[model samples]
Target: MDTTSNLEEAVEVLQQLGLKEYEARCFVGLSRLHSGTAKQLSEMTEVPRTRVYDAIRMLEAQGLVEIQHSSPQQFRAVPLEEATETLRDQYDARVERLHDALETVEIVDTDDESSVQQVWAMTGQDAIENRTNDLIREATDEIVLVVGDESLLTEDLIDTLNEVGNGVDLLIGALTETIQDRIRVAVPEATTFISGLEWLHGENATVDETAIGRLLLVDRSTILVSSIMPTTREERAVFGEGFGNGLVVIARRLMAQGLLTVRDPKQ
Candidate 1:
Protein backbone atom coordinates (compact mmCIF):
# COMPACT_ATOMS: atom_id res chain seq x y z
CA MET A 1 0.00 0.00 0.00
CA ASP A 2 1.29 3.49 -0.89
CA THR A 3 1.87 5.73 2.15
CA THR A 4 -0.49 8.72 2.35
CA SER A 5 2.34 11.26 2.14
CA ASN A 6 4.04 9.49 -0.79
CA LEU A 7 0.68 9.48 -2.60
CA GLU A 8 0.34 13.19 -1.91
CA GLU A 9 3.79 13.96 -3.32
CA ALA A 10 3.14 11.82 -6.39
CA VAL A 11 -0.18 13.60 -6.91
CA GLU A 12 1.61 16.93 -6.73
CA VAL A 13 4.12 15.90 -9.41
CA LEU A 14 1.33 14.75 -11.74
CA GLN A 15 -0.63 17.95 -11.20
CA GLN A 16 2.49 19.96 -12.04
CA LEU A 17 2.46 18.19 -15.42
CA GLY A 18 -1.19 19.22 -16.01
CA LEU A 19 -3.01 16.11 -14.75
CA LYS A 20 -6.25 16.34 -12.76
CA GLU A 21 -6.51 14.83 -9.24
CA TYR A 22 -8.16 11.53 -10.26
CA GLU A 23 -5.76 11.07 -13.18
CA ALA A 24 -2.75 11.97 -10.96
CA ARG A 25 -3.68 9.39 -8.33
CA CYS A 26 -4.20 6.65 -10.92
CA PHE A 27 -0.85 7.37 -12.65
CA VAL A 28 0.97 7.52 -9.34
CA GLY A 29 -0.38 4.08 -8.43
CA LEU A 30 0.77 2.63 -11.76
CA SER A 31 4.24 4.24 -11.43
CA ARG A 32 4.78 2.86 -7.95
CA LEU A 33 3.97 -0.71 -9.03
CA HIS A 34 6.04 -0.54 -12.28
CA SER A 35 3.11 -2.14 -14.16
CA GLY A 36 -0.38 -3.09 -13.03
CA THR A 37 -3.84 -3.86 -14.36
CA ALA A 38 -6.43 -1.05 -14.14
CA LYS A 39 -8.41 -2.87 -11.45
CA GLN A 40 -5.27 -3.43 -9.37
CA LEU A 41 -4.14 0.24 -9.70
CA SER A 42 -7.65 1.41 -8.77
CA GLU A 43 -7.52 -0.73 -5.60
CA MET A 44 -4.07 0.61 -4.59
CA THR A 45 -4.60 4.31 -5.51
CA GLU A 46 -8.26 4.28 -4.20
CA VAL A 47 -9.57 5.34 -7.59
CA PRO A 48 -12.75 3.74 -8.97
CA ARG A 49 -12.01 0.92 -11.43
CA THR A 50 -14.18 2.68 -14.02
CA ARG A 51 -12.14 5.89 -13.75
CA VAL A 52 -8.84 4.03 -13.57
CA TYR A 53 -9.15 2.62 -17.12
CA ASP A 54 -9.89 6.06 -18.56
CA ALA A 55 -6.97 7.62 -16.60
CA ILE A 56 -4.58 4.93 -17.83
CA ARG A 57 -5.80 5.41 -21.42
CA MET A 58 -5.29 9.19 -21.12
CA LEU A 59 -1.79 8.74 -19.67
CA GLU A 60 -0.91 6.29 -22.44
CA ALA A 61 -2.05 8.80 -25.05
CA GLN A 62 0.25 11.40 -23.45
CA GLY A 63 3.21 8.95 -23.70
CA LEU A 64 3.53 8.97 -19.93
CA VAL A 65 2.16 5.43 -19.67
CA GLU A 66 2.11 2.38 -21.94
CA ILE A 67 -0.72 -0.16 -22.33
CA GLN A 68 -0.71 -3.95 -22.83
CA HIS A 69 -3.55 -5.82 -24.51
CA SER A 70 -3.44 -8.77 -22.10
CA SER A 71 -6.17 -10.16 -19.80
CA PRO A 72 -7.83 -7.28 -17.87
CA GLN A 73 -5.30 -5.01 -19.66
CA GLN A 74 -2.12 -3.57 -18.10
CA PHE A 75 -0.34 -0.15 -17.94
CA ARG A 76 3.19 0.90 -17.06
CA ALA A 77 4.77 4.33 -16.47
CA VAL A 78 7.55 5.51 -18.81
CA PRO A 79 10.96 6.00 -17.22
CA LEU A 80 11.12 9.43 -15.60
CA GLU A 81 14.20 10.68 -17.48
CA GLU A 82 12.91 9.51 -20.85
CA ALA A 83 9.54 11.20 -20.26
CA THR A 84 11.19 14.40 -19.13
CA GLU A 85 13.53 14.52 -22.13
CA THR A 86 10.71 13.89 -24.58
CA LEU A 87 8.64 16.74 -23.17
CA ARG A 88 11.66 19.05 -23.11
CA ASP A 89 12.44 18.30 -26.75
CA GLN A 90 8.88 19.11 -27.78
CA TYR A 91 8.96 22.39 -25.87
CA ASP A 92 12.28 23.38 -27.43
CA ALA A 93 11.05 22.63 -30.94
CA ARG A 94 7.92 24.70 -30.42
CA VAL A 95 9.97 27.63 -29.16
CA GLU A 96 12.36 27.43 -32.11
CA ARG A 97 9.51 27.40 -34.61
CA LEU A 98 7.88 30.38 -32.91
CA HIS A 99 11.15 32.32 -32.99
CA ASP A 100 11.63 31.60 -36.70
CA ALA A 101 8.11 32.81 -37.48
CA LEU A 102 8.74 36.00 -35.53
CA GLU A 103 12.00 36.63 -37.38
CA THR A 104 10.27 36.28 -40.75
CA VAL A 105 7.60 38.76 -39.63
CA GLU A 106 10.22 41.20 -38.39
CA ILE A 107 12.01 41.14 -41.75
CA VAL A 108 8.82 42.22 -43.54
CA ASP A 109 7.90 44.88 -40.98
CA THR A 110 11.39 46.37 -40.98
CA ASP A 111 10.84 47.58 -44.54
CA ASP A 112 8.15 50.01 -43.42
CA GLU A 113 9.26 53.55 -42.66
CA SER A 114 8.58 54.04 -38.97
CA SER A 115 10.14 55.45 -35.82
CA VAL A 116 10.00 53.71 -32.48
CA GLN A 117 11.62 54.20 -29.07
CA GLN A 118 11.72 51.15 -26.86
CA VAL A 119 13.18 51.47 -23.36
CA TRP A 120 14.77 48.56 -21.47
CA ALA A 121 15.92 48.80 -17.85
CA MET A 122 18.46 46.61 -16.07
CA THR A 123 19.55 46.85 -12.44
CA GLY A 124 22.94 46.02 -10.86
CA GLN A 125 26.42 46.79 -12.17
CA ASP A 126 27.11 43.27 -13.45
CA ALA A 127 23.90 43.00 -15.46
CA ILE A 128 24.40 46.46 -16.93
CA GLU A 129 27.97 45.67 -17.95
CA ASN A 130 26.98 42.30 -19.36
CA ARG A 131 24.30 43.91 -21.50
CA THR A 132 26.78 46.50 -22.67
CA ASN A 133 29.33 43.81 -23.58
CA ASP A 134 26.74 41.91 -25.57
CA LEU A 135 25.97 45.07 -27.51
CA ILE A 136 29.66 45.52 -28.21
CA ARG A 137 30.01 41.94 -29.48
CA GLU A 138 27.16 42.56 -31.91
CA ALA A 139 28.77 45.73 -33.21
CA THR A 140 29.77 45.24 -36.83
CA ASP A 141 30.70 48.80 -37.69
CA GLU A 142 31.02 51.22 -34.77
CA ILE A 143 30.55 51.78 -31.04
CA VAL A 144 30.01 55.16 -29.34
CA LEU A 145 30.42 56.07 -25.70
CA VAL A 146 29.86 59.07 -23.41
CA VAL A 147 31.03 59.15 -19.82
CA GLY A 148 29.75 61.42 -17.04
CA ASP A 149 32.43 60.23 -14.67
CA GLU A 150 35.41 57.91 -14.87
CA SER A 151 34.50 56.01 -11.70
CA LEU A 152 32.26 53.62 -13.62
CA LEU A 153 35.12 52.23 -15.71
CA THR A 154 36.01 48.65 -14.85
CA GLU A 155 38.45 46.07 -16.18
CA ASP A 156 35.75 43.77 -17.51
CA LEU A 157 34.22 46.35 -19.83
CA ILE A 158 37.60 47.44 -21.12
CA ASP A 159 38.68 43.85 -21.66
CA THR A 160 35.58 43.05 -23.70
CA LEU A 161 36.23 46.08 -25.89
CA ASN A 162 39.83 45.04 -26.51
CA GLU A 163 38.84 41.53 -27.55
CA VAL A 164 36.13 42.70 -29.98
CA GLY A 165 38.61 42.83 -32.91
CA ASN A 166 38.97 45.55 -35.58
CA GLY A 167 35.50 45.45 -37.09
CA VAL A 168 34.07 48.13 -34.79
CA ASP A 169 34.89 51.81 -34.45
CA LEU A 170 35.09 53.01 -30.83
CA LEU A 171 34.22 56.61 -29.96
CA ILE A 172 34.09 58.40 -26.63
CA GLY A 173 32.90 61.84 -25.54
CA ALA A 174 34.64 62.99 -22.30
CA LEU A 175 36.51 60.96 -19.66
CA THR A 176 39.05 61.70 -16.90
CA GLU A 177 42.78 61.13 -17.16
CA THR A 178 42.73 58.02 -14.98
CA ILE A 179 39.91 56.44 -16.99
CA GLN A 180 41.70 57.26 -20.23
CA ASP A 181 44.81 55.55 -18.89
CA ARG A 182 42.83 52.43 -18.09
CA ILE A 183 41.26 52.31 -21.57
CA ARG A 184 44.62 52.98 -23.26
CA VAL A 185 46.23 50.19 -21.29
CA ALA A 186 43.35 47.77 -21.94
CA VAL A 187 42.80 48.68 -25.60
CA PRO A 188 45.80 50.35 -27.16
CA GLU A 189 44.36 50.05 -30.69
CA ALA A 190 41.01 51.66 -29.85
CA THR A 191 40.12 55.03 -31.41
CA THR A 192 38.78 57.52 -28.85
CA PHE A 193 37.87 61.23 -28.89
CA ILE A 194 36.70 63.94 -26.48
CA SER A 195 34.31 66.83 -27.13
CA GLY A 196 31.17 68.66 -25.85
CA LEU A 197 31.59 67.84 -22.11
CA GLU A 198 31.65 71.53 -21.05
CA TRP A 199 27.86 71.52 -20.77
CA LEU A 200 28.14 69.54 -17.53
CA HIS A 201 30.16 72.05 -15.47
CA GLY A 202 28.08 75.05 -14.47
CA GLU A 203 30.97 77.54 -14.19
CA ASN A 204 33.87 75.60 -15.74
CA ALA A 205 31.71 74.90 -18.77
CA THR A 206 33.98 77.24 -20.72
CA VAL A 207 37.16 75.47 -19.63
CA ASP A 208 35.97 72.01 -20.73
CA GLU A 209 33.23 72.35 -23.30
CA THR A 210 31.97 68.75 -23.60
CA ALA A 211 28.95 66.60 -22.94
CA ILE A 212 28.74 64.82 -19.57
CA GLY A 213 26.91 61.57 -19.99
CA ARG A 214 27.34 57.81 -20.56
CA LEU A 215 25.97 56.63 -23.90
CA LEU A 216 27.12 53.45 -25.68
CA LEU A 217 26.21 52.94 -29.31
CA VAL A 218 26.79 49.69 -31.16
CA ASP A 219 26.91 48.95 -34.89
CA ARG A 220 25.45 52.39 -35.63
CA SER A 221 22.11 50.89 -34.62
CA THR A 222 21.85 49.77 -30.99
CA ILE A 223 22.52 52.16 -28.09
CA LEU A 224 23.08 51.66 -24.36
CA VAL A 225 22.92 54.69 -22.08
CA SER A 226 23.10 55.12 -18.33
CA SER A 227 22.46 57.94 -15.86
CA ILE A 228 23.02 56.25 -12.50
CA MET A 229 26.26 56.84 -10.62
CA PRO A 230 27.53 53.29 -10.08
CA THR A 231 29.57 54.54 -7.11
CA THR A 232 26.84 56.32 -5.12
CA ARG A 233 23.63 54.28 -5.48
CA GLU A 234 22.65 50.94 -6.99
CA GLU A 235 23.25 51.77 -10.62
CA ARG A 236 20.94 51.06 -13.54
CA ALA A 237 21.27 51.32 -17.32
CA VAL A 238 19.08 51.20 -20.40
CA PHE A 239 19.78 49.14 -23.53
CA GLY A 240 17.89 49.95 -26.73
CA GLU A 241 18.37 48.05 -29.97
CA GLY A 242 16.51 48.69 -33.23
CA PHE A 243 16.36 50.98 -36.22
CA GLY A 244 14.46 54.07 -35.07
CA ASN A 245 15.61 56.32 -32.21
CA GLY A 246 18.77 54.23 -31.89
CA LEU A 247 22.37 54.29 -33.04
CA VAL A 248 21.53 54.41 -36.74
CA VAL A 249 19.55 57.65 -36.43
CA ILE A 250 21.27 59.33 -33.48
CA ALA A 251 24.86 58.54 -34.44
CA ARG A 252 24.24 59.78 -37.97
CA ARG A 253 23.02 63.10 -36.61
CA LEU A 254 25.96 63.37 -34.25
CA MET A 255 28.41 62.72 -37.10
CA ALA A 256 26.79 65.03 -39.67
CA GLN A 257 26.42 67.95 -37.27
CA GLY A 258 30.02 67.75 -36.02
CA LEU A 259 28.77 67.09 -32.46
CA LEU A 260 31.40 64.33 -32.17
CA THR A 261 35.16 64.22 -32.62
CA VAL A 262 37.03 61.19 -33.94
CA ARG A 263 40.40 60.23 -32.51
CA ASP A 264 43.22 59.61 -35.00
CA PRO A 265 43.63 55.86 -35.42
CA LYS A 266 47.39 56.24 -35.95
CA GLN A 267 47.91 57.70 -32.48
Candidate 2:
Protein backbone atom coordinates (compact mmCIF):
# COMPACT_ATOMS: atom_id res chain seq x y z
CA MET A 1 0.00 0.00 0.00
CA ASP A 2 1.05 3.63 -0.45
CA THR A 3 2.40 5.77 2.43
CA THR A 4 -0.88 7.74 2.61
CA SER A 5 -2.90 4.53 2.87
CA ASN A 6 -0.53 3.19 5.54
CA LEU A 7 -0.91 6.39 7.58
CA GLU A 8 -4.69 6.25 7.37
CA GLU A 9 -4.72 2.63 8.42
CA ALA A 10 -2.39 3.27 11.33
CA VAL A 11 -4.54 6.20 12.48
CA GLU A 12 -7.62 3.97 12.45
CA VAL A 13 -5.84 1.29 14.49
CA LEU A 14 -4.62 3.86 17.01
CA GLN A 15 -8.13 5.24 17.36
CA GLN A 16 -9.39 1.77 18.18
CA LEU A 17 -6.63 1.51 20.78
CA GLY A 18 -8.25 4.45 22.70
CA LEU A 19 -6.72 7.40 20.90
CA LYS A 20 -8.99 10.12 19.55
CA GLU A 21 -8.97 10.90 15.82
CA TYR A 22 -6.77 14.00 16.24
CA GLU A 23 -4.47 12.14 18.64
CA ALA A 24 -4.13 9.25 16.22
CA ARG A 25 -3.34 11.55 13.29
CA CYS A 26 -0.89 13.62 15.34
CA PHE A 27 0.92 10.51 16.61
CA VAL A 28 1.24 9.07 13.14
CA GLY A 29 2.51 12.36 11.78
CA LEU A 30 5.09 12.73 14.55
CA SER A 31 6.20 9.10 14.22
CA ARG A 32 6.92 9.59 10.51
CA LEU A 33 8.93 12.79 11.13
CA HIS A 34 10.69 11.50 14.33
CA SER A 35 9.92 14.90 15.97
CA GLY A 36 8.20 18.17 14.99
CA THR A 37 6.61 21.38 16.27
CA ALA A 38 2.82 21.52 16.82
CA LYS A 39 2.41 23.68 13.72
CA GLN A 40 4.41 21.25 11.60
CA LEU A 41 2.40 18.26 12.93
CA SER A 42 -0.89 20.11 12.27
CA GLU A 43 0.16 20.80 8.68
CA MET A 44 1.36 17.21 8.01
CA THR A 45 -1.64 15.44 9.63
CA GLU A 46 -4.22 18.05 8.52
CA VAL A 47 -5.46 18.30 12.11
CA PRO A 48 -6.59 21.79 13.16
CA ARG A 49 -3.94 23.79 15.00
CA THR A 50 -6.33 24.29 17.96
CA ARG A 51 -7.00 20.53 18.32
CA VAL A 52 -3.33 19.57 17.94
CA TYR A 53 -2.46 20.80 21.41
CA ASP A 54 -5.34 18.88 22.95
CA ALA A 55 -4.34 15.73 21.08
CA ILE A 56 -0.69 16.13 22.04
CA ARG A 57 -1.65 16.51 25.70
CA MET A 58 -3.60 13.26 25.56
CA LEU A 59 -0.74 11.38 23.89
CA GLU A 60 1.65 12.78 26.52
CA ALA A 61 -0.71 11.60 29.31
CA GLN A 62 -0.82 8.14 27.70
CA GLY A 63 3.00 8.08 27.61
CA LEU A 64 2.92 7.60 23.83
CA VAL A 65 4.70 10.87 23.08
CA GLU A 66 7.34 13.12 24.65
CA ILE A 67 7.44 16.92 24.58
CA GLN A 68 10.55 19.12 24.35
CA HIS A 69 10.01 22.43 26.17
CA SER A 70 11.39 24.83 23.54
CA SER A 71 10.17 28.14 22.02
CA PRO A 72 7.66 26.27 19.75
CA GLN A 73 7.49 23.08 21.94
CA GLN A 74 8.45 20.08 19.78
CA PHE A 75 6.62 16.69 20.19
CA ARG A 76 8.09 13.26 19.42
CA ALA A 77 6.30 9.90 19.24
CA VAL A 78 7.60 7.40 21.72
CA PRO A 79 9.65 4.54 20.20
CA LEU A 80 7.14 2.24 18.47
CA GLU A 81 8.10 -0.92 20.43
CA GLU A 82 8.07 0.88 23.80
CA ALA A 83 4.73 2.57 23.09
CA THR A 84 3.13 -0.79 22.09
CA GLU A 85 4.50 -2.55 25.20
CA THR A 86 3.18 0.27 27.41
CA LEU A 87 -0.28 -0.02 25.91
CA ARG A 88 -0.23 -3.81 26.30
CA ASP A 89 0.80 -3.50 29.95
CA GLN A 90 -1.93 -0.95 30.63
CA TYR A 91 -4.51 -3.20 28.94
CA ASP A 92 -3.43 -6.25 30.94
CA ALA A 93 -3.52 -4.35 34.23
CA ARG A 94 -7.02 -3.05 33.53
CA VAL A 95 -8.22 -6.53 32.65
CA GLU A 96 -6.77 -7.97 35.84
CA ARG A 97 -8.43 -5.30 37.96
CA LEU A 98 -11.77 -5.95 36.27
CA HIS A 99 -11.46 -9.67 36.88
CA ASP A 100 -10.73 -9.13 40.55
CA ALA A 101 -13.65 -6.71 40.90
CA LEU A 102 -16.05 -9.13 39.25
CA GLU A 103 -14.88 -11.97 41.47
CA THR A 104 -15.90 -10.02 44.55
CA VAL A 105 -19.22 -8.78 43.18
CA GLU A 106 -22.32 -10.63 44.40
CA ILE A 107 -24.72 -11.83 41.74
CA VAL A 108 -28.38 -11.01 42.24
CA ASP A 109 -29.98 -13.82 44.22
CA THR A 110 -33.28 -15.26 43.06
CA ASP A 111 -35.37 -18.27 44.02
CA ASP A 112 -34.43 -20.70 41.24
CA GLU A 113 -37.71 -22.63 41.45
CA SER A 114 -39.86 -19.51 41.24
CA SER A 115 -37.60 -17.62 38.87
CA VAL A 116 -37.63 -20.27 36.15
CA GLN A 117 -41.20 -21.49 36.49
CA GLN A 118 -42.29 -19.57 33.40
CA VAL A 119 -41.44 -21.08 30.05
CA TRP A 120 -38.84 -19.00 28.21
CA ALA A 121 -38.48 -19.11 24.47
CA MET A 122 -34.94 -19.19 23.15
CA THR A 123 -34.30 -18.62 19.43
CA GLY A 124 -31.12 -19.04 17.38
CA GLN A 125 -28.73 -21.96 17.50
CA ASP A 126 -26.17 -20.26 19.74
CA ALA A 127 -28.79 -19.21 22.31
CA ILE A 128 -30.22 -22.72 22.47
CA GLU A 129 -26.79 -24.32 22.85
CA ASN A 130 -25.69 -21.88 25.56
CA ARG A 131 -28.90 -22.29 27.58
CA THR A 132 -28.66 -26.07 27.29
CA ASN A 133 -25.07 -25.99 28.45
CA ASP A 134 -26.03 -23.81 31.43
CA LEU A 135 -28.75 -26.30 32.42
CA ILE A 136 -26.37 -29.24 32.03
CA ARG A 137 -23.68 -27.62 34.14
CA GLU A 138 -26.20 -26.73 36.85
CA ALA A 139 -27.38 -30.34 37.14
CA THR A 140 -26.35 -31.81 40.48
CA ASP A 141 -28.17 -35.16 40.65
CA GLU A 142 -29.00 -36.58 37.24
CA ILE A 143 -29.65 -35.63 33.62
CA VAL A 144 -32.08 -37.38 31.26
CA LEU A 145 -31.59 -36.57 27.59
CA VAL A 146 -33.60 -37.73 24.58
CA VAL A 147 -31.73 -36.98 21.37
CA GLY A 148 -33.65 -37.14 18.08
CA ASP A 149 -31.29 -35.03 15.98
CA GLU A 150 -27.59 -35.76 15.73
CA SER A 151 -26.81 -32.18 14.64
CA LEU A 152 -27.64 -30.86 18.09
CA LEU A 153 -24.90 -32.93 19.66
CA THR A 154 -22.15 -30.32 19.66
CA GLU A 155 -18.63 -30.84 21.00
CA ASP A 156 -19.19 -28.34 23.81
CA LEU A 157 -22.38 -30.12 24.84
CA ILE A 158 -20.55 -33.43 24.86
CA ASP A 159 -17.75 -31.96 26.96
CA THR A 160 -20.27 -30.51 29.43
CA LEU A 161 -21.95 -33.93 29.77
CA ASN A 162 -18.56 -35.58 30.29
CA GLU A 163 -17.78 -33.12 33.08
CA VAL A 164 -21.02 -33.77 34.96
CA GLY A 165 -20.31 -35.43 38.31
CA ASN A 166 -23.63 -37.27 38.57
CA GLY A 167 -25.52 -39.79 36.49
CA VAL A 168 -26.54 -39.08 32.88
CA ASP A 169 -28.96 -41.19 30.88
CA LEU A 170 -29.04 -40.65 27.11
CA LEU A 171 -31.74 -42.03 24.78
CA ILE A 172 -30.53 -41.62 21.21
CA GLY A 173 -32.64 -42.13 18.07
CA ALA A 174 -32.11 -41.99 14.29
CA LEU A 175 -28.39 -41.28 14.36
CA THR A 176 -25.70 -42.95 12.30
CA GLU A 177 -23.22 -45.30 13.92
CA THR A 178 -20.39 -42.77 13.54
CA ILE A 179 -22.28 -40.00 15.34
CA GLN A 180 -23.32 -42.38 18.09
CA ASP A 181 -19.72 -43.49 18.45
CA ARG A 182 -18.62 -39.86 18.83
CA ILE A 183 -21.13 -39.30 21.63
CA ARG A 184 -20.10 -42.49 23.39
CA VAL A 185 -16.46 -41.52 23.24
CA ALA A 186 -17.10 -38.01 24.56
CA VAL A 187 -19.49 -38.95 27.35
CA PRO A 188 -18.30 -42.35 28.48
CA GLU A 189 -19.99 -42.08 31.90
CA ALA A 190 -23.47 -41.66 30.39
CA THR A 191 -25.73 -44.71 30.14
CA THR A 192 -26.60 -44.88 26.46
CA PHE A 193 -29.80 -46.43 25.10
CA ILE A 194 -31.40 -46.55 21.67
CA SER A 195 -34.83 -44.94 21.49
CA GLY A 196 -37.34 -47.38 20.08
CA LEU A 197 -40.03 -44.92 19.03
CA GLU A 198 -39.80 -43.47 15.50
CA TRP A 199 -41.25 -39.98 15.61
CA LEU A 200 -40.93 -39.72 11.84
CA HIS A 201 -42.10 -42.23 9.25
CA GLY A 202 -39.06 -42.59 6.98
CA GLU A 203 -35.33 -42.01 6.64
CA ASN A 204 -35.90 -38.97 4.42
CA ALA A 205 -37.68 -37.06 7.17
CA THR A 206 -36.71 -33.37 7.08
CA VAL A 207 -36.06 -31.05 10.00
CA ASP A 208 -39.70 -29.95 9.79
CA GLU A 209 -40.63 -33.43 10.98
CA THR A 210 -41.95 -32.88 14.49
CA ALA A 211 -39.66 -35.70 15.57
CA ILE A 212 -36.56 -33.63 14.93
CA GLY A 213 -36.18 -32.31 18.48
CA ARG A 214 -34.44 -33.15 21.74
CA LEU A 215 -35.65 -33.35 25.32
CA LEU A 216 -33.54 -32.57 28.38
CA LEU A 217 -34.45 -33.06 32.02
CA VAL A 218 -32.01 -31.79 34.60
CA ASP A 219 -32.26 -33.21 38.12
CA ARG A 220 -35.96 -33.80 37.28
CA SER A 221 -36.54 -30.09 38.02
CA THR A 222 -35.61 -28.18 34.87
CA ILE A 223 -36.52 -29.12 31.30
CA LEU A 224 -35.63 -27.95 27.81
CA VAL A 225 -37.36 -29.02 24.59
CA SER A 226 -35.62 -27.90 21.41
CA SER A 227 -36.08 -28.36 17.66
CA ILE A 228 -34.38 -27.38 14.44
CA MET A 229 -36.38 -25.13 12.10
CA PRO A 230 -37.01 -26.71 8.70
CA THR A 231 -36.29 -23.77 6.44
CA THR A 232 -33.71 -21.63 8.26
CA ARG A 233 -32.30 -24.64 10.12
CA GLU A 234 -32.00 -22.41 13.18
CA GLU A 235 -32.53 -24.09 16.55
CA ARG A 236 -35.29 -23.08 18.93
CA ALA A 237 -35.98 -24.13 22.51
CA VAL A 238 -38.44 -23.73 25.39
CA PHE A 239 -36.98 -24.10 28.87
CA GLY A 240 -38.27 -23.86 32.40
CA GLU A 241 -37.74 -25.05 35.96
CA GLY A 242 -39.81 -25.85 39.10
CA PHE A 243 -41.06 -29.25 40.22
CA GLY A 244 -44.71 -28.31 39.84
CA ASN A 245 -44.33 -26.51 36.48
CA GLY A 246 -46.65 -27.99 33.86
CA LEU A 247 -43.89 -28.37 31.30
CA VAL A 248 -41.62 -29.94 33.89
CA VAL A 249 -44.33 -32.35 34.94
CA ILE A 250 -45.06 -33.32 31.34
CA ALA A 251 -41.36 -33.75 30.53
CA ARG A 252 -40.88 -35.94 33.61
CA ARG A 253 -43.84 -38.13 32.74
CA LEU A 254 -42.74 -38.42 29.11
CA MET A 255 -39.21 -39.41 30.13
CA ALA A 256 -40.56 -42.00 32.55
CA GLN A 257 -42.88 -43.39 29.89
CA GLY A 258 -40.02 -43.52 27.39
CA LEU A 259 -37.81 -45.42 29.83
CA LEU A 260 -40.57 -47.91 30.56
CA THR A 261 -41.33 -48.28 26.86
CA VAL A 262 -37.66 -48.98 26.12
CA ARG A 263 -37.46 -51.52 28.93
CA ASP A 264 -40.73 -53.40 28.24
CA PRO A 265 -42.25 -53.91 24.78
CA LYS A 266 -45.30 -55.87 25.85
CA GLN A 267 -46.76 -52.92 27.74
Superposed model 1: Cα runs more than 4 Å off: 1-115, 200-213, 229-232, 246-267
* Candidate 1, residue 66: how far the Cα is off, in Å: 46
Worst 10 residues of 2 by lDDT: 258-267
Clashing pairs in 1: 196-210, 196-211, 197-210, 197-211, 198-208, 198-209, 198-210
Query: Deviation in angstroms for 182 in model 2?
Result: 3.2
Give per-model TM-scores. Answer: 0.46, 0.53
Angstrom error at residue 1, model 1: 58
Candidate 1: give its CA RMSD in angstroms: 11.0
- lDDT against the true structure, per candidate, is 0.66, 0.76
